[model samples]
Target: MAASWSELMLSKLVGRCNNFFQPGSSRAMCKPFMVGDQQVGWVWPGVEKHIQRFPDVFMVEDKQVSLCPSLQMYEERTARVQEVMVKLREEGEFIALKGWRDEMYEVFHQRSSPPVFRMERTATALLGVKQYGVHVNGYVEHPQKGPLMWIGRRAKNKSTYPGKLDQVTAGGFTAGLTAQEVLVKECAEEANIPQDIALTAQPAGAISYFYEDERGLFPEIQFVFDLKLPLDFQPVNTDGEVSEFYLWDMDKVKEQIAQPDFKPNCAMVVLDFLIRHGHIHPDQEPRYLQFLENLHKTLF
Candidate 1:
């Protein structure tokens, strides 16, 4: 006997939905779904609209089921996919989604956990492990020199990109902290900026960048933020995570970033913010020339 179409689809949906939840151990996290019998980690399921509106967002493989998004819809549908995740929690037959399973595990493990921010990790056998970090490119208006970007020269002793100019304040997001919480804590701990000052800064957005370290550990996501500081703000280094700080003129910063010293995607993200806000003048250099071209196309 063959499976009905709806039955097959439902099974696939359940499988993909279960993949979202996994257990976190002390050393590493456990992934829910297996890829060719090997567990894979968390994957962002595009946006909510595609999950609800597009038929192809869900798929099945070998009756053992594997799911992935259609390439055309992946970028535009991220938020939409996340929004409908709760629906799967309610309707799917996956053990992870069942409240009883989580409750039983909590009781058995003697740990209290929350739903939205649960920890998950990739399979242990993978050569490289990725971790998430937050970076803030802070800017303040200078009374005499216009807008200045805050930057830090990383310490030479650092394990990764050492002695290079980097974001003003950056740190790993520890357990039980939101991005906002991490940013505030990082600002104080790394740059000696007050928690109130960091908290008050507006969140521009996030950009994810990936890179690999010398040891084969992939520090995949640097979640970037643009923070506006007061004109009179002066930061002191509290923890020496940053060796030194400088307020660079926009042009100089852009020029320095274009060189090989700066981290690739991090520099580009800051340049994107500057170009979008018209701070980097079109007449300045080739970088701004491209920005102007993009702006013209965007406008007309």
Candidate 2:
């Protein structure tokens, strides 16, 4: 028998996710690079050349090159690292990445509830560092039509994923906010969701993946969420970050997702929603058991 579109969608999403970790030891590549007990950030083994390129900030050895241990003496060495990163940008080293956001992302040795230290957000991926992000899958249950999902098309002028499909609410986990705080704030800013409604979102499990592309290695964590909006409530794009809003029925959503319309990472968030809501059942998917196991599995 031929597989259903839903089946293919689920399988492809899982396979694409696993490919990130399958190339090398998934766990090996995602290992935290530390000094003594302190985990400064993630470092890929093969990135010694890149690290060596900046000798002052990165102390390069034969096999490993890490930030100087003395950098720990300061409150945050991100300013020093930012200097090197800025020089690289000036020399045309970084392409396709945006300018500095003036926002700092926490670098952790472990996935601490509150991360370890603040680093310039722009440089983390360039340095093969792991970072945290939150994705909330906004949805509504119709009395007769089952569940419909809220999707956003990103603003064309945005630097990353411009004009691509995104979740209802998604943003990087910055230095000062908790996961829940980010969820609520992004919901309001991106979708005009009220605090009471956004607070109703349930904490779904998370997904972890690492991929290396022309840009750099992105070791990412997406904290998932499931939110059910009231039947009459319509999502409004308030911040202008999103160009439009889409309310797709389950079947239409499956078909739309089968195409390449959605952003790469946001697809995983939707797939997780489908599985948890029983849209994709065990018998419907060949990789059902494997996908279940991998969803919450962490490289960290």
Candidate 3:
């Protein structure tokens, strides 16, 4: 019995997703990024070398990379980090710094606690810091054809994941904003979804993963939302971030996600949706439990 395309694709997606969760070896190699006793992030080898230059601001030891304990104030710590990031950007020390937007991301020891400091958005991944984003699964339930999803094709001009398929609307959770706030903003900016309609989106929990590549480490959490649109509603790309949009049936979506064209993270969002909507059943999927476990990995 040869494996069906759906079976093969599901297996492949699970394997790809597994890669993000298996950061045991890489995590061991990276130094803990600490503030006082709390480990906020991980410092990659290259970033560790650069932070070593600023001994006054960063106290780099063999076991860990830490912000100087003397800098107690949040503003002081933020300014000090920004100074180092600016210097690195000026000297072209890191490829990630090249895309330095003025955007900031607040870094916290724990999600519920106050931020220790804020840093440039792009530098977060380079430091192996945890990043949060919102991904909305916009779909319409047709009476005859069943549920169809609205998928966005990222614009070619975008710095990352250009020309790839993505969620209908998505955006990073920036400094001082809640996940719901981001969802509303992204809904309008990315897909022209009205605020009233966007507000109706149900919170679908979250999925997290940790992965390392040549650029650096990614400890990412995507806060997922599900919005069922009216049968006649269509998503328009207001922001140039998305070039086009497609309304795909579940089978087509499954096939597309199995291919390289779809963004990996967004594919996970879709997979989670399928499972929650009873599209992917436990009786049918051999690795059902494993898939559920892989979707939500612990990351601090």
TM-score per candidate? 0.53, 0.86, 0.94
The best candidate by lDDT is 3
For residues 86-171, write the lDDT of model 2, one tens digit per residue.
76666665652455677788776676544544677777766667778999988888889888998899999887779988898898
Q: Sort the predicted structures by lDDT, highest score first.
A: 3, 2, 1
lDDT of 3 by residue, 58-129 (tens): 999989989999999999999998999899899997878888889999898888889999999998877788
Residue 51, model 1: Cα distance from true site in angstroms: 34
In order, candidate lDDTs are 0.48, 0.72, 0.85
lDDT of 1 by residue, 74-175 (tens): 233333333334455465532333322221000001113332112222211121223456778888877898889998888887755678778888876454
TM-score, candidate number 2: 0.86
Better of 2 and 3 by lDDT: 3
| For model 3, the run of ten residues with the poorest summed lDDT | 1-10
Off by over 4 Å in 1: 1-130, 217-219, 280-300
Ranking by TM-score: 3, 2, 1
